[model samples]
Target: MTDQKKTHQPQPPIAVSPDEAARLAGIGRTTLYAALAKGDLPSIKIGTRRLILVDAIRDWLAQHQG
Candidate 1:
């Protein structure tokens, strides 16, 4: 009998600060903040770090793309 093992590769997590998120989304930081304020853009506030999920950003693009 032989044993086999499978290996899984990990993908880097997509993380961005407010500034980077604004740049990546092609929007101003104010607009981003406004959206967050209005609960339009989902964000997580852990400790003092606020993070928006990359997948959420992608979904936003998918639904809001012009």
Candidate 2:
């Protein structure tokens, strides 16, 4: 009997840094920040770092889509 090793796939992050969120959303950092500032998008701040939820980014984009 041969034993096979199972391969694990990496899961996507639930939250990401602002820069990464911007890249994932296909928007400029400044635009992303503006949305965050305007309360159009939600983010969480830990220490001095800001993180945006991946789901929030997706929902925001969907809401703004023409």
Candidate 3:
């Protein structure tokens, strides 16, 4: 496959840290945690860490972007 194709390929279960998730969501870490605590954000427990699916996040943004 071409380099561009590789770079453009869909990600499978993108894992992000709390800090990175906050940055991507345009909120502070505290706010991110607050949402998580309130069960407002989508997440899954992977092993010991909490993970947010990239497809979920993308769809969320698309909804808001419209």
Among the numbered candidates, top lDDT falls to 2
lDDT of each: 0.81, 0.96, 0.72
lDDT at residue 6 of model 2 (Cα atoms)? 97
Models 1 onward score TM values of: 0.71, 0.93, 0.60
Q: Name the candidate that leads on TM-score.
A: 2
lDDT of 3 by residue, 45-65 (tens): 878888876665666556557
Sort by TM-score, top down from the best: 2, 1, 3
lDDT of 2 by residue, 1-66 (tens): 899999999999999999999999999999999999999999999999999999999999999889
With a 3 Å backbone cut-off (N, CA, C), the pairs that clash in candidate 3 are none
The superposed Cα distance between candidate 2 and the true structure at residue 4, in angstroms, equals: 2.2
Question: Lowest-lDDT window of 10 residues in candidate 1?
Answer: 11-20
